[model samples]
Target: MGDKVVKFEPITHVIFDMDGLLLDTEKVYESIIKKIASKYGKEYTLEVRSELTGRTQVDSAKIAVEKMKLPITIDEYLEQYHPLCREFLQTPDLMPGAEKLVRHLAKHNIPIAIATSGNEWLSKIKTQNHVNLFSEFHHTVYGSSDPEVVNGKPAPDIYLICASRFPDNPSPDKVLVFEDAPNGVEGAYSAGMQVVMIPAPEVEEELKRHATLVLTTMEDFVPETFGLPPYDE
Candidate 1:
């Protein structure tokens, strides 16, 4: 498994997905969607969430509304969502080893950035609790607000847009991505970059195949496998 998970090629830059990869906010968003769907006697199961992961706010709203057969417009669903999301986003919890890995990369002068399916407003809200930590990134590309990110995950738009933003405009192969959504892994792969996926518990096995590396938690990441410096501790 170790051999299978490690891609020994050296990578120059790193891109991270925000919600599930670095922050434990995916669960919060999940609960909110489930709660809303339940009002219409619809179930928001793991399979549904797997499909929605890494999708933009509007995109997720559309799937949820349709999948649940909710008697609400996507706009109405979002209106109810924002308020509940606002409260939880401001109090995000970091995923296992997220801070350690990020800081280590930063300390080594690795160019790192965040690329999220969230809009600017949601990004700001989601990152409020860890302003200092998030500031370590070179920049953050918000999918909804970034004109270059015309398409969300399951498309290469966001990853390609993110890689281009780096100072060197590095080749796709030289950039590595960390994601927690199957769509994110596929998107990064489509962009010609190697991705490390830490998928949601219920994501299907088929989706895991897209990742160059997959781990149960951020804690399992070994930078040396990707030719990045190992943790000093």
Candidate 2:
């Protein structure tokens, strides 16, 4: 008899969504955005952060400009915030169990990739020298030139692109995605990957619909529970 395919497949590749998922960087990022907006006499709020999550900077700036009625152009907004982004990289913190989870997945020989809405230069700062955690595990990394082209999060373009980048293993179904925001989780779902969410307190309830699995911390990620093999590499 042929081997039966389980309804829920085991994860073979792990595609990580950066920003809120792997790093506790969202609050700082929001702070910087607010700081930049304030210079234009616009009052940005936490609610705006939720709106901007997973969007490209260009798209985000458009929203900010339209909703907040900012007096500045997107270019002017970028000028204010981009420098803050670079400065923010001076300190980086790993999300709970983020390092352990990546190392665990990598130790098992699971191919790892990064899909983010951040620009290449800022993304490198976040992944490479800033935290020193993600640099070790990610085999491939991708970021948009501008957030609008791929529709950013709540769309699958970034995740699909990351899946396509895996030269030796290109199947989207073989991947597990880790996300922390509703947009990111939805993107992973649209990309046809198993999604797990480790959300912050603010968005925990809203994210339930998008996640295949929800946990407070990455420490809960046990391979056996999900029918994945132990770390064997």
- The prediction achieving the highest lDDT against the true structure is 1
Q: What is the lDDT for 201 in model 1? A: 79
lDDT of 1 by residue, 1-233 (tens): 33464545789999999988999988888889887888888899887888888998889999888877899999999999999888767888899999999999999999999989999988887778799999999989998788787789889999888888888999999999999899889999999999999987778788898788889999999998888999998
Task: Score residue 127 of candidate 1 by CA lDDT.
Answer: 77
lDDT (Cα atoms) of all candidates against the true structure: 0.89, 0.75
Shift of residue 195 alpha carbon in model 1, Å: 0.6
- lDDT of model 1 at residue 37? 87
- Candidate 2's displacement at residue 103, Å, is 1.3
lDDT of 2 by residue, 54-109 (tens): 77778788778777888889888788878988988655677777787777766676
Residue pair clashes in candidate 1:
none
Model 1 — TM-score against the truth?
0.95
List the candidates' TM-scores in order. 0.95, 0.86
